[model samples]
Target: MKYVQLFFIFLVTAITLRAQTIPYLQRQGTATQLIVEGKPFLMRGGELGNSSASSLAYMEPIWPKLEAMHLNTVLAPVYWDLIEPEEGKFDFSLVDGLLKDARAHDMKLVLLWFGTWKNSMSCYAPLWVKRDLKRFPRAKSAEGVSQEILTPFDDRNRDADVRAFQQLMRHLKEQDGQDHTVVMVQVENEIGMLPSARDHCAAATKAYRQPVPAELMRYLTQHKKELIPELQQHWQANGGKTSGTWEEVFGKSLATDELFMAWHYARYVEAVTAAGKAEYPLPMYLNAALPREGKQPGEYPSAGPLPHLLDVWRAGTPSIDFLSPDFYNPRFQYWNDLYTRSGNPLFIPEIRFETGDEAKAFYAVGHYDALGFSPFSIESTDHPAEEPLGKSYDVLDQLAPQILAKQGSDQLDGVLLDKDALEQQITMGGYVFTVKHDFTLGWSPGAQEEQWPLAGGLILQTGPDDFIVAGTGLVVTFAPVKGNDLIGIGRIDEGEYIDGKWTPGRNLNGDQSHQGRHLRIPVGDFGIQHLTLYRYR
Candidate 1:
């Protein structure tokens, strides 16, 4: 009897723990958080270059490099061709290898499913699917040329992807579901239409001529006021028709063609994502290849959840948690603003790996309340520990707890600064703060260079008069939000968080705070400091 009771207790505890550990998203205040093991998680993350995770032996040395960078999460690829080399038989060796290695390094993962499409091509599709063209047709250009991309309009193509993705998700559930090692899944890689805005295949043509789906038309009618400006203008220009073919409703143009393609692509992804969620639900998303400046539809990748198409994607793929951007362009703020609108939580899956990513990470998490930030080609650096990003990550890792606690409130914000945009004014905790790039001091040797290094940091107000500032190349000053009362720096302490506890170091009062004129973290320095402000007449 005693043995049976003990066994039953163990079984019950295991079941309860499993139920609690499945990763999910929850809204806290104005922000959304990725909750892992029942607590909010911030991904100090990086994405491996394409093909890095294909071979375990190739990834062996990369694990320590990631650890050195203090990345708690990794975004790696799971190739459809590799997993389903033969028609039916599946090999999970690569997926298993990634899970094993990621576990060994004590890191979580966001697996990118390179199925059906990658960067607008069917490059990662299984050879069997590619060769059996009759069984699996290709998307055609306007001139009737069969391109390498698979047509999403085809049931066969979508079903093939659906099966492969289903198997992968089911395997994850059986293997790592309880462990929750894989926190999220990116359904496809930079999915888009190219060479033409929309597919010109016979099936696509038929669909395009037919009246727009009532579901989409209904979505437009119901959310008319809430639609994005770009989309709103496009629809209104066509008299906001209640019923007609794609051209009749949205008009004849590249923009309309792109809109037509966006709907099909989104529905295709929705099918795959819905199937995977049915097997083992995980928070899934899609990433877009940002459009270049002044590029028209089809001149770029056309459409795959770009901001103007957000309404279409949301209308199509309710199962998808969000859509993200893979950055290789400037205007980080411009792109992020669009993605984060309409209650979508920002999570940067890829940015060009470069020097300024450290500062951007702070600005992203603090300013945008971003769930995470990642740089692509994370392992290319030779000196992993010495990398500036690694040092920034060290401070981020220490402040993760505090950052999470203060997120979703008015007390938290971030700033990104450079020569052109040197200063930003922030109002928090009944005080005004002037944050500027460290070079604004005009005394630094490199201040006069042609270009200034990117500088940024996050500020979190811990109390009415106290705050925590962390990042590189920033100087901050505080003043009264109202009246002419002078603000005085009561005290400042350079510190580090040891096991989530703040350990104060220097009494940065006289010179470090510049004789109470300002509180600064100079260029090339990455650390945290506590500051308290007082009012003086």
Candidate 2:
């Protein structure tokens, strides 16, 4: 009788705890937040390289390094082969270990489901699944040559992938559901077709000749105003027809084939996402392998969640929260702007782990009011503390509290610069600021160098005349926004945020401010400066 009562009590406690919270995405005005444990969280996050999360022993040495790097969330892969190596049986040693280690480090996890497809190839699928090609057919090129990529047209392929995924989600619910440690799950990695815009498999080929789905046509018609321009132009040029084959509905082009592929890929992912959500109901998303410049559909990955295919994705996957970008492109602002259109919240899951990644982090969050920012291959660095990314993350940690508060509000903006573009302008608090790269000063050795490093900052309007300016290598000269009036920096206090409050260290007026000409924080110096502006006619 005593044992029965104790078991019942524990079970009820677990049920109640699970009911209290689940990881979700919440929109506060224009900003979106990853709500973990019923609280809004900014993911100061990083993703381990493709193979980093496979071993507990391998990850042990890097925990302290991540702690020093200031990452609060980790995006790691959950291998289909490792978790469910056999047919019906399962093993969760790796999953449980990842959860345990993340909790130990006081970090959150976003599990990437490498099921059936990873980077458009079935490379991550279990050996049993891979070996049985007839059971799970692969996608084919235009000449009927099969590629490693899986075709979405096969229901059998979908069923097997769905089962493995369902099992994974079910296991996650049992293990970490109460803890809310794993916040989000990416359905697959860079899913798309290669060397073919649309799969040449028999089912896919037949479907391509068939009329475009009525649902997709309806979406294009309804969301015409909001649809991306490239897609819209093709639809309009086709006389905005509602009924026709794939090429007839859109146009006869590589993009048309891509449209066909995007729809099928989205539908396939949607089924997986919807089924997984049924078990646990966590927020899910898909990441796009960006299309390179001048590359047609087959030249790139072709279909995976690119901007033009957004409507297709939206039409296909209501279960998906939003589409995310894996940016390796240099035109950071352009790509970010493309992803954030039509109320899609910006989150960069993976980016090139380069020198400018740190600056890009500041520009991304500060300028875009982004949900989160993370650079790829997080464990590859030799000395974590010595890295520029660590310094950038340090500054971001201090400003995070304020950044979250003002994210959806219009009081925040950021700037970015390179050798080609040395300066930019920002308007806030009724004043226009000439924000420029610190290399313009010509005082530092970098000023003499041909290349200008990425310099950027966040301008937060704390009051009508007062503001907080934080970032490296930037100078701001202010003037009245609506009239001809000279605006002078009344006071510029260099400081750091301690315990959510500003502590001033030095006052800049003479050379630091160009003798009251412009307020500046020089190159290679990352700090916060509080400034008060006064305007005179």
Candidate 3:
């Protein structure tokens, strides 16, 4: 009996240590990689529709579809109301079910905590918390009408959220810590204040009139040079005061209200995230509902982790690891550039699930070295094999090995082409390569349409004069950057990657490459081709 007890003790300790180990974002060369179980991991991920993960039945057919798309991770939600309906009492059936199913499907998970706020609404709060307006207050609009959003000013609100989140983390640690199946977790979804720039409730109104937190002021004063342009401009407009009320320090405007609310929001989230860390300490992040074009702070979901409010969020929630973009906007490149500013790693937790997203995914991973990209409403799509996204993911999976190796290095570059932009120029390895939209070949039916389809490629310079170029569409041409010598493609091996090793299928030449004039993947064909070039004197 004593031996049996000792054996059980040892087993429990082993599981605890395994669970404690977490995957982290680490830098290699100049590129950041998501390190899972002490090795680099690429997230070929997809997010479920809002209500899809709620039922085990709804997700039944979806699992195979995700696997068909070559996804490595599933971004599913964990609702606060469902998890803890009776306050202190918690229910983790849904979470456990997800873990079991995920393991069965051989996929990792990134659970999105739909707590307090989901897209800036208190839609996920429990009935008890939502019922008690006095204790669990809601944010208000300008005319004192209460909005469904919770006020960050209330301590009860923060404590309730923290308690619920802590319980969830504890449960995850107990259940999944040893398996390490869930690589990272999202603390909340598209967090923001809406209908107005700032919360107008009594508590929020009272706090707005007070001076900004000294910690925030100090952060602004300390990181003045590195502040995002919008935040910096707001501070500079009011003489960059050492300390004062929100308006007095940052001027009287909607931006000021946003700045004020952002601080409280960030602080509130920090408490919840810190509490969760105490239990499981999994990698946690927050996603921002981007500020829309032509929309003011109040017009869009203001605050959250929007680019301009990074300073406030950084000061408010130092516990939060990183910020990610929910990319619904058309300007993918511009938004990606903005999020990665200030050395923050780029990870797309959600984007529009349009077919064009496949191109954006290739460009993001290749150009920006993004940690991961997940399309929203992934299960909504039918027939993964017929979809362009599936084909894109399949190719991406093949090239991931080389892509991860070249991350943070100048040898890696990519370009996106659509109807508006048909071509781009890149210089790498002492040569200038011209990448164009495949439609330029004018051979395919879509090529002659009024608008060209999306096409892109990831270019990796593996050797001094050799490159592994993979993607659909576009013709690539090479030239010596500093000489009159003509460039020639000595050999082009069209092949597939299996287990990080290139297996050549066909020697592409003649018509496939415009008679060896350049390298072409052609329109309507998705492939990878290895090219070795030589410059003639």
Candidate 4:
């Protein structure tokens, strides 16, 4: 009997250890949370510049800067050309060095695989692959001129990428599997076709004339009601044929050309992703370079994972966890709303890395229940500690516990304020909150400026009468949702969370709360305030 008990205990211990080593995504309430080491982790992350992670000695000073900035995760690339220099030879010294440094600094990493494609060019491919044109053909333009991108129609190109990626994953599992310093991986960097919507290479041209795959047609028909408006409208406009060639089914326009290319690109990426996941399953995603407004297909890198091609990518790449946008264009909110369709979790892997990102971070986590957020070229700042983003990150680190708990719940809300869009109304805990940009107040220093700097913050209801508001540049007033009763401020305490505990510093009233008219965190300041409210007739 004692021997039986010991055997059971050993079995349970081994199972738990295996579960704790792999990081994965899980659904929490209405949001999808990345579970690491058996707990939910919010990534306050930044992506290093393209060439930053190529050398360990060059990255020594950069680590301290990242630590000072309060970043918990670093998004660095693992270049294919460097990792696999020769046909079948592999080198993992760069990857190993990155893992060791990140672990030493107590930071997590999201590895970006700069594999077959980077920004629609095959510049990252190994020399052998690039030089052997006969063995591995390049995609051609409409005029039959060869371009730099490898044709996805070739089996050799896809197999080569799969072998390299599988090796990388296998190495990570054998080397750092227990520590799990790496949380997630991006499959490629901004994959898309350049200067043309569809490849005009001989293989591509021949494939384009073949009948559309039955699998994709089935997906569209099965998900007809749920397809994005653009894709659905295009299909319906062209008669929604069940059996026909790419041009015959989707019409002979540039839109159809883009659709054809999108399907092939997704399939190629899926092959690589699936192979890596088989070696070591981690949450994997793809990022898209958003197209500029009014640009037709072929004008920009076409048929990459943009919003319109999401359906095609989804149908092709079941191994890809989700699709994300790399922000270099305008319309932040517009793009975010589109990306979060059909319960897809939001994780911004790359943004412009500017002044207003602090606010967007708050709004993204609070408003959309985003899994994580990151900025591009994160090591460019001169003063890492004094940066506005650093200050914002410090507060976020303190509030991460509460933020993670309240995500996907009505108790949390965030607001982004700018000159044109000054005010937003939020209803929580039976009270209506009127949140506005700090510049809306005439007495503020930058109120009269021609362009107002962006201001934003978040509010979390802790109790029926208690709430916490944290952010920069904002004034808030509250009113009851039901009755026509006046809401009075019982007390407002300016405070900070130390060790996940609220430490109040000042009882803000009179002048601090604008003589009880409103609660304000000035434009230049980043802080947290705990407030208690009461109702009066």
Top candidate (TM-score): 1
Candidate with more favorable, higher lDDT: 1 or 4: 1
- Candidate 1 residue 473 Cα shift, in angstroms, is 0.5
Residue 222 in candidate 2 has what lDDT?
Answer: 89
lDDT of 2 by residue, 290-387 (tens): 97888888888989998878888999998999999998876788888988888898989988888887778888888887878888899899999887
Worst 10 residues of 3 by lDDT: 15-24
Top model number, lDDT: 1
TM-scores of all candidate predictions against the true structure: 0.98, 0.95, 0.96, 0.97
Q: Model 4 compared with the native: what TM-score?
A: 0.97
Q: What is the lDDT of residue 515 in candidate 1?
A: 95
lDDT of 3 at 394: 90
| Candidate 3 ranges with C-alpha deviation above 4 Å | 1-20
1-537: candidate 1 lDDT, tens digit per residue: 999999999999988888657999999898999999989999999999998998899999999999999999999999999999998889999999899888989999999999999999999999999999998999998889999999999999999999999999999998898888999999989988888988999999999999999989999999999998899999999899989999999899999999999999999999999999999898999999999999987778877989889999999999999999999999999999999888889999999999899899999999999999999999999999999899899999999999999889999999999988999988999999999999999979999899899998999999989999999999999888899999999999999999999999999999999999999999899999999999999
In candidate 1 the C-alpha lDDT for residue 130 amounts to: 96
- Candidate 4, 230: how far from true, in Å? 0.9
The Cα error of candidate 1 at residue 438, in Å, is: 0.5
The residue-level lDDT of candidate 1 at 196 comes to: 90
lDDT of 3 by residue, 111-133 (tens): 99999899999999999999998
Q: Determine which window of 10 residues in candidate 1 has minimal summed lDDT.
A: 14-23
lDDT on C-alpha atoms for all candidate structures: 0.94, 0.87, 0.87, 0.91
